[model samples]
Target: MSETSKVVLVTGATGGIGSAVCLRLANSGYSLILAARDISKLQAACAALDRPGLPSHRWISVDMSSDASIASFSHELATDGTVLDGVVLMPPQMRPTGDCQPPADMWRQLFQSNFIGPLELLKSAISTMRPDPSQGRGAKIVIISAITSVQALGNYATSNVLRCAWLAQAKTLAFAMGERGIHVNTLSLGGTLTPDYVASIDLRATKAGVTFSERLAEETLNIPLRKYGRPEEVALAVEVLLSPFSDHMTGVNLLHDGGFTRAY
Candidate 1:
């Protein structure tokens, strides 16, 4: 890799899609700082992305569900003099998938994880992206929301609502932070073949007393592509937003659902 490689921070980096994005960015020659709630899992992800002769990736334990943790992590980054070129924000991976209304506590926690915590992190560290606006360099932010944000999911009410709110938050931030040279956007995705999606499908199958394949087929049947997206495919879209290709694009919600979303 070149010495001029960019530094990118990827939150929730141990999750299926997050890890995929980390690997893809690493392979593309970007230095990464991986963050998650679990150091063990985050370390494992870093190890997986390690190339013997390349600059090794770094891991930080960050509990995005907690305000203190997010503040502490942001403070650490801010004071360390590390300037981030890009950020990939993956909201909490463990999401409620049933149709039943979640309890008040569940709703609060989901909002914290999916909305408040991330917004706080950005508030604390966004300035570090462009310490001097005159430098003619801006930072990029890609928020990973679900296509459920745009097209409501019958079973995933909490995710649908919370993630949609997050998309709005990103759009709002884009305008607020534009003058600072920070590009903020949201990527609303549909049925990607991540482990979480597969597990959710399996649970639905068990609940319906149908074979997993049957449930899977039913889920994809309405999708125009009749298939789930690969993690790398989504990662590539993230890569695009992080690169110069999206310099002119901000506050936009790009859907990468392989025709799964019914909404425009």
Candidate 2:
């Protein structure tokens, strides 16, 4: 299939990494279905892309924290019947972590957005993808997960647990959909210079009575590469995972950390 005819769905489309991934895919000629919670941010993202002459890629409001919103988004996609060639699932960032455990209600909300909602959308999306040789190239699914999915982080207990669950979910989907020609995989990221990562460092800087840059530099020392990754750098990996280049790879977590994670 031609690039312009292919459709890709991206959740959390307004975020730092997510937006970069969208831009990369747009430049590669894929029609995008941008999904996120805030309508204004979504509009701003679409405007920044500026695809004036060609078919305008769409933006749909989606609250991963709410089942109704996810269902609505899925219903719209199913109704449109746009043959999805790629699906990128980037769950919304979680609240800052602390030493104390959060309330049970908070955990439920976190799981709903980080785990359940995306899974539901995946189910709907699979139905709209090319399933076999007769239907053209197979569809690809990329779930953006954190490095904590493999490693344990005491501070980010909720994320550590939920992201691990998502990894398993992606692997299961990979097997379930492999015969149908859908590639399901997860991209595990380490520290990137995204707004969320920067804000987290800034908070630590404030509490430690140090400059944000200094804190950021100190944090980078833990990474073997001695720097936080740029959003575009991570987006490149997303491109690879979604492209035909990764046709042989599936049911795996491709780590994009700058060597911060030591585990193999």
lDDT of each: 0.83, 0.84
1-264: candidate 2 lDDT, tens digit per residue: 354567889998999998999898888777788999899999989878756554458898988778898889888988987888899998888764864577899888888887888888878878888757465567899999989889987678788888889988888888987877889889988888888778878999999999998998898888999888889998889988888777877898988889889987
Q: Mark the regions of model 2 whose C-alpha exceeds 4 Å error after superposition.
A: 1-4, 52-55, 99-101, 134-136
Q: What total of clashing residue pairs does each candidate reach?
A: 0, 0
lDDT, candidate 1, 1-264, per-residue tens: 457778888987888899889989999888899988888898788888988656667877888789889878988888788778888988776455685677889888877887888777766657668624577677899999888778777778888788778877888888888888889989988778888778878999999999999998888898898888989899999999998798788999998887877665
TM-scores of the candidates are 0.90, 0.92
Error of 2 at 121 (Å): 1.4
RMSD of each: 2.3, 2.1
C-alpha RMSD between model 1 and the true structure: 2.3
Candidate 1 lowest-lDDT run of ten: 124-133
Name every residue pair that clashes in candidate 2. none
